[model samples]
Target chain A: MKTFPIIRVVTKILIPYILLFGCYVQFHGDYGPGGGFQAGVIFASGLILYGLVFGLDAVRTVAPPRVIEKLMSLGVLIFAGTGVLTMLLGGNFLDYDYLEHHVLPGILPTGQHLGLFLVELGVGVTVTAVMTMIFYAFAGRVQAKHVQAKQEPTP
Target chain B: MTAIDVAILLFLAITAVTIARIRDLWAAVMFTGIYSFLSASWMLLLDAPDVSFTEAAVGAGISTVLMLSTLALTGTTEKASGAKFRPIPFMVVVLTGCMLIYGTLDMPQIGDPSDPIHIHPSPSFVERTQGDMHGLPNVVTAVLGSYRGYDTLGETTVVFTAGIAVLLILRRGKEEDSKTGGRPGSAAASGDNA
Candidate 1:
């Protein structure tokens, strides 16, 4: 990977656009064919491509393992916590109608949209983190094995 | 079906057969990616854009890369030690295929309005989504995010749990290394030591 100048150049050019498209898919999912799951996977693929081209160290600089671990839990928390908030707001669990209640007048759909957006965000975050972590674990372990294999030939 | 759909299906069959025949793991992984793309196109041809999008992204893109990473951990050449064909396992596969085909014989034709799947519960979801679900035009999201919110929550928890489990199993820190006598390989190394 380090020796391939063409891959480095092309990946650098393509990655930003991929990330942007992932964000578009995440946000525009309500009106389109994509949502958090697809968007998260796409976003993670961009990072994974960067990792594949540039190496795991570059990916770590972008998103360290600790940050990824925290983000994974936080995403689930946001999702479940939305339901808890709805429960506390005197509505049935996950009832988005309660979200916009009394805060804004005359816009009945605001709550549903807001709640859906937040939930999707949570899902997107969690998925992105998990996919990246899985890649990291696999790639890191393989790299370690390669180093070991090089250092000590099997007797 | 259109000619294009038939052509794509033929391509999918070819790819599947090629994947099965290929002994090189890398080629097999590439063929799997091709299979995913072809299936995604088939989904689009069937007027299922959402399913196609997911299939293209996750199946073709992410899963292929993950398999490649797994190949890096293991070996690229698949072992041919078990190459001898056994008739019993082949019979089981044939039986399963026959059962699946027989089961599908009872299914209603595609898009039949009288189909039980299109009749019950789905109509209600469709009816209420636009009006009561605050005009979220995408009925799929309305159903997945709001109507079946509990199920989605459960799925999210499942994803989180899987991530946790994988990290716990594969992640090695300085602490783990100290306990394992500084060998960074998998349990194979530990087994050898014992």
Candidate 2:
């Protein structure tokens, strides 16, 4: 098989695992050398690498700039919202201990490990979108410059 | 000095020399990438995986590529600055290096658990990080996002600011029919039509 389809097939097979690994890193960060920041970058890098191999046009068709912008802003909000929720729940911002609470009367609850999970997910979204945005920005610049040069008459 | 230390020092020296001597801006950028790659390796050997990873992405990867593209948009030829090397500034830099080396002479041995960084507060930081924060075993996040979160916030802001600045410098210029590179007219702009 040609490399493009092979890569597509391989990445298709691997996307789920890549996502799972990202989750693992984000969740297991408290004990390891990785956490949201590293996991976010790695998650974003996978998509960026995909774009590099496949082409920018393919990625843009799948995730348009407008959608990406919305996701990017939404990601920031999601991250901030978690912190806001913790504050509303009478904890300091991002305080997991405060998040570990029984919402219903006398119900047992696990500590708010899920809070970090959500935060990491948000971070991953924002990071990937922003990195792609950066890539596109430069890509656009090169296009614009080339167009201008071509249109210009000889000196 | 240890072998790793010597290698780091050697690369660091080369980095400085390359920065000074490479007349072409593109080569300077590539050398800087090499410098960062070497530093990442050194940091890995020193058990600072997080720093190494960050350096790899931001320093060697993003920064190098960005600098090269910027050079492409601008010019690769280094403009001649017609100033002789100032002896005073040279002496000051030399003095600073000497002082830093002298300070390192009294540092704790590499990887000494009894060192202040290891003994005084780090253990407690480690111990506290485990029980506190979200359940992720990555204490770096615990420390970064929880314990000393302000610094991490600052770091994140730096990433955000850099992203914005890059976007701005690289904003699409006006394009005409003859120009092949402009965003909208080009085939690669949004990729949807493509």
Candidate 3:
């Protein structure tokens, strides 16, 4: 990947747009044909493409394994936590209608939109972390094997 | 179906057959990606843009890359089997496919307003989302995110679980490496088992 200037340059140019599109898919999902699942996968693909082009170490540096592991769990927590919050606010589990406030009538009808946003964000976060982590695991295995083979040449 | 739908479906069938017949794993993976893209197009033609988007991204983009990486770890060419033509599995597959086609005989036509799905709370969700969610525009998002929120939570949990399961199977801890005498092949061995 480092040797091919054309491939490297094209990948570098494409990555930012991919990330931006992922953001657009995440945020614009409410009004468009995308949601957290698609957005997360898209974002992960962008990072994976970067990893494929620049190498596993580069991607791992960009998204550390420890942080990704935490994020993998944190997304589920964020989603479940929202439900718990709604329950505490005198609503049924995941009942976003109760999320509405008389104070901020201008925001949107009920708390449904905000609740959706948070839940989707959680989904997006978890998905991105998990997908990227999977890529790292697989690619890391190949890298490890490559190093091992180099170290020990079979006669 | 329209001409475009027919064309896409034709391409999808050809790609699917190509993938099944191709002995080269890399070409098969590429063909599988093409099949997914065609399926996405067909989904779009059926007016399910959200499903199409998901199919295109996860099916075509991510799965292809994942399969390619898996190929990197494993053999790229499938080994030739010594067995002769097996009729039992072929008959079973044909029988199952026939049964599935027979089952679809009773299904409602595409976009039929009188379909069972179009009735029974579908209209209610679509109607209420406008007022309840304040004209969110994308009713599918509203349904998934709000109306059927619990299901989405469950799905997120499912994704989380899958990731954890994969990590457990593949990820090698430093302690495990030392315990296994720094055998790099152990991870690949476990992955193959998985």
Candidate 4:
């Protein structure tokens, strides 16, 4: 495999920290300042940084373009599906009060508290996957351009 | 004005000047990305973390990349009409900025509890939000996901739509190699090299 020398080592070190920060952002959304969207994008951005350093081909090896595309759609579906569920449950669209089907030992909590968590998860999934898909798409395009330029005639 | 407010105004000025002055279309676009990142930071300082998060994720990251891709797909950079002064547009922008600044003079300070925003049903929602809603302790989240659920859903749809539109336009066309300048008709010529 071709190496980027300095960039590769630097990104490798930074990747783990970015991953940790992203998780903190995700879980900490409820307490201070953060949410699914920020966490997801930051997480995807760290992976994208790795892809950039090692070259696009390596990224495709782990998360191929077709798979990334499918995951993006899946995220949207998960988010929309939750909303549709709320609609069917006799509440307004995205009314998470209906999502209070979580199981606990004794009591069942609803709406603002427990339901919001699931909904945020849906949002987080969609935002993150879609972001990664976008980065992959562009890298694929760049590679395609490189190959095409090579194929051109000199005459 | 507070230090953060001053910083935000400085960003707005930078964004405006960057938009106005940059000749290279690519550089201008990058400035817009900078503008977006700054705006997200400003919003965070304004106590609107949810909006800040959305703006940072969508504006600073995905949107900028998509814009750069569009520049790649199209060849219309053409250097922007030889950098004309364009007084009419400049005056309009300055006038709009002045109007905005003038209007802000009468507004409440950031985080002021009596600022009409926090004092309304918002406070009621903030106060009794957890008890009735049950498990969610975060009032900001509670408002976004439950009370203003439709708005949040709409925002998600908007994000999805933007992504889909970019994907559609950038998708590999039926002609295959045409997008990257390797149309199928040229395949025969390349094969002749073998």
Cα lDDT, all candidates: 0.84, 0.66, 0.86, 0.70
What is candidate 3's CAPRI-style docking category based on DockQ? medium
Better of 2 and 4 by DockQ: 2
Cα lDDT tens digits for candidate 3, A82-141: 899999999999988778877667754358887888899999999999999888778777
Quality class of the docking in candidate 4, CAPRI style = acceptable
- lDDT (Cα, tens digit) per residue for candidate 1, span B16-81: 999998999999999999999999999998778778877988789889988998998888997777
Give the number of the best model, judged by TM-score: 3
Flag regions of model 2 displaced more than 4 Å: A1-28, A45-59, A101-112, A153-155, B82-85, B119-123, B133-136, B149-158, B165-170, B173-194
lDDT of 4 by residue, B1-194 (tens): 68888988798887878777767778878888888889888887777876787687667766677677667756535555656689999899999989998999999876787889777665577668767676456777767766776676676666667667767765565533343244233444644753
lDDT of 2 by residue, B19-92 (tens): 88878888889889988888888888888987886677667865675576567567898887887989999899
As for TM-score, the candidate ahead, 3 or 4, is 3
Give the alpha carbon lDDT tens digit for every residue of A48-152 in model 2: 555555655455555666666566566666677777877898988876566675566334333455566566556666766677677667655654566579889
Ranking of models by TM-score: 3, 1, 4, 2
The two-chain DockQ for each candidate, comma-separated, is 0.48, 0.36, 0.53, 0.33
Local lDDT at A120 for model 1? 83
DockQ of 3: 0.53
Model 1: per-residue lDDT, tens digit, A1-155?
Answer: 75888989999999999999999988888777777777888899999999889776567667877788898988889888999999999899899888876655664336887778878888889999999998888887887787778989865
Q: Candidate 2, A36: how far from true, in Å? A: 2.4
lDDT of 3: 0.86
True contacts kept of each: 0.63, 0.38, 0.71, 0.40
- Model 3: lDDT of residue B143: 84
